[model samples]
Target: MKKLITVFILSLLAFTAYSQQADRFRFQMDLGAAAPKGGGIGALVNFEPQILVQRNLALGLRFGVAGLAKDIVYYDIPKDFTGEISANTSFSGTANYYFNYKKGKAAPYVGAGFGYYTFSSVNIESTDIDPDDIGNLRASFAWAPMVRAGVELGKFRIGAEYNFVPKSDLQNIAGEVIGQSTNEYFGFTLGFFVGGGRWGRFQ
Candidate 1:
């Protein structure tokens, strides 16, 4: 949570630093639901600060956080787990190109980015006689690629994104692998932003 706050503050500071160039500065936020590829659902939120280098092209830094609840089943070890909550954070460089886009009108875009994903530690319990027999597990981070497509109409945005994150191993106190958790997910967003004057790129 502390890290999330720090990143948000940095985003605001970025806006302040670049606010001088109103025509080129853009700050947008998106909030909506997230569905894990492994089979679960939760919420997602993002803050992006951008610079419009060209009328139809913009580059930005995206900071996002996602949380989900999932269940993992291991056939080999005969492990059946439930209620595993995973939280992930990301910071990435994004480039978006608008098609027949205008500031106040509908702005349709396709985007791509590469980023680092940090997954939070999760607890995996043993379905044996006692659940506490197994110790707590620690989570590790991964570097993954992502893609997004969406549209921005006036100050509102609706988009969809996919994160191609790798599976993470759950390790116990002895550093032995107990199980694996799927980390990839899909996010749907509906949000609004402040900034970017009303204008159009193409005639």
Candidate 2:
């Protein structure tokens, strides 16, 4: 969590420095739900700081957290293993282009971003056995590409996004590959922006 905080602070500072030079700034907070490719549900939260670089173009940094839980079952053995399997922090740079920039008019936007995703280690707990016997599961970092489309109405924005992360092998304390899984997910978000110099016009 400390590493996540440090990355967020650095990204925020970068946004602040760029905001001073830009004509307009926008800050957005988002809460959403995510569904992974397999069979799991997760919660997502994001903080985005953006600057309008042009009338229809904006650049921003996205700091996000996601936590997912799912059930794991073995084919030969019948056992119940259900717990949080994935928790991740993401930091990305984004660029968005708005189709319509008229005030009070709904603006549709399509955006893309690239980022690094850091997944935390998770331990699976089972009621049948002692938790200490189960080893910690570690996941690797991957480069994630994101694509999103959204509509901004007044100060509120609704969007859907897809994250593409390749499958990464999970490792144990002995550095042996135990399983392979991807962190890819689809998310729907509702957000509100607090600051923007003007609704549609850029200075």
Candidate 3:
């Protein structure tokens, strides 16, 4: 039993070392559209700088914001209250798992992670009956799941990710706007990795 345990420990250490040696460092940026299902669309942009913590594991930060234009149509209303909504700036973080097909200059990967997105908005154009609406939406504890397939070129990386955030309330608004929405932001990142090492995080 003692010999078996010792061998197991040594094997674990070797695996860890191998894993570290096989990792790639990268930085990414993405831009796309934040299209809401409710006849609203916005420009979505995100910048992510990531550190390959280990094989298949990456830790990063995402900083971006979106501006949504409202295209609402009223049927029973006397006057049409058509206006656009500019979503306030919001932020979030990310952790991803990269599956690099090859350990070359161009490595393609796919992974997913959870995020917390903050959304806020004010009435861009309101009808005459609509008061000076100071709307603030709070979806603080939001879930962000994303799937990305992109190529990593040396210290710079470029790819597109389809990020989805679960439906939350559009704060400071009248009506329960609780549902899921898509971030629709595609990233094109350009940054270099420190501590030059071989990309071999895949064992």
Q: How close is every model to the real structure, measured as TM-score?
A: 0.85, 0.85, 0.55
**lDDT of prediction 2:** 0.77
Model 1, C-alpha of 86: deviation from truth (Å): 4.0
lDDT of 3: 0.49
lDDT tens readout by residue for model 3, 91-176? 44567655564456556566655555555543435444334343443333455666666655665556556556554433335554
In candidate 2, stretches whose alpha carbon ends up further than 4 angstroms from where it belongs are 21-23, 71-83, 125-133, 200-203
lDDT (Cα, tens digit) per residue for candidate 1, span 61-144? 888889877766543466556646655788877888887534357888899888778877776555552445446766678888
Cα lDDT tens digits, model 2, 136-163, are: 7777888889999998887888999999
Candidate 2's TM-score: 0.85
Candidate 2 differs from the real structure by a C-alpha RMSD in angstroms, to one decimal, of: 2.8
The TM-score measured for candidate 1 stands at 0.85
Error of 3 at 32 (Å): 3.6
Which pairs of residues collide in model 1? Answer: none
Per-candidate local distance difference test: 0.77, 0.77, 0.49
